[model samples]
Target: MSWSIRIGSIAGIRLQLHVTFLFFLAWIALSQGLLTGHAERAL
Candidate 1:
């Protein structure tokens, strides 16, 4: 569907956002921040 599929250009390229991927990225970032002792940065 057009609502879910993107058909456009981002500097001559297309782009899409995946909610699951974003959550995983945030989780990884938070884990790294906590590991280095920056708890505030995690949030």
Candidate 2:
């Protein structure tokens, strides 16, 4: 296999994983903040 093909595949996989991580981080931050606020209100 050509080096270009191998590099391209690696780059594509890295980009995909970077995007997935950003999505999950945003979701977790939002959800945890909301839960903390609710818990504080209940106290």
Candidate 3:
């Protein structure tokens, strides 16, 4: 029973990390796009 609980916790942690990484990746892409647009406007 304890082993099953530990495995569940580990799976949850992995899922959380995956979600965090995806969020950051999306944020970086959005920021990059905004910066590129700003640079074009300046030019």
* CA lDDT of every candidate: 0.75, 0.53, 0.52
Badly placed stretches (over 4 Å) of model 3 are 1-17, 38-43
Which digits, one per residue and each the tens of the lDDT, describe model 1 over residues 1-43? 3334454667978876655676788899899999999978886
Ranking by TM-score: 1, 3, 2
lDDT of 2 by residue, 4-39 (tens): 222234535632234556667877777777878863
TM per model?
0.56, 0.43, 0.45
State how far residue 35 of model 2 sits from its true place (Å): 0.2
What's the ranking of the predictions by lDDT, best on top?
1, 2, 3
Q: When superposed on Cα atoms, how far off is each prediction in RMSD?
A: 3.9, 10.4, 10.3
Q: Model 1: clashing residue pairs? A: none
The runs of at least 3 residues in candidate 2 whose Cα sits more than 4 Å from the true structure, single-residue gaps closed, are 1-16, 38-43
lDDT of 1 at 43: 67
Q: Model 2, clash count?
A: 0
Of candidates 3 and 1, the better by lDDT:
1
Give candidate 1's whole-model lDDT. 0.75
Q: Distance from true position, residue 27, model 2, in Å?
A: 0.3
Q: What local lDDT does model 2 show for residue 4?
A: 26
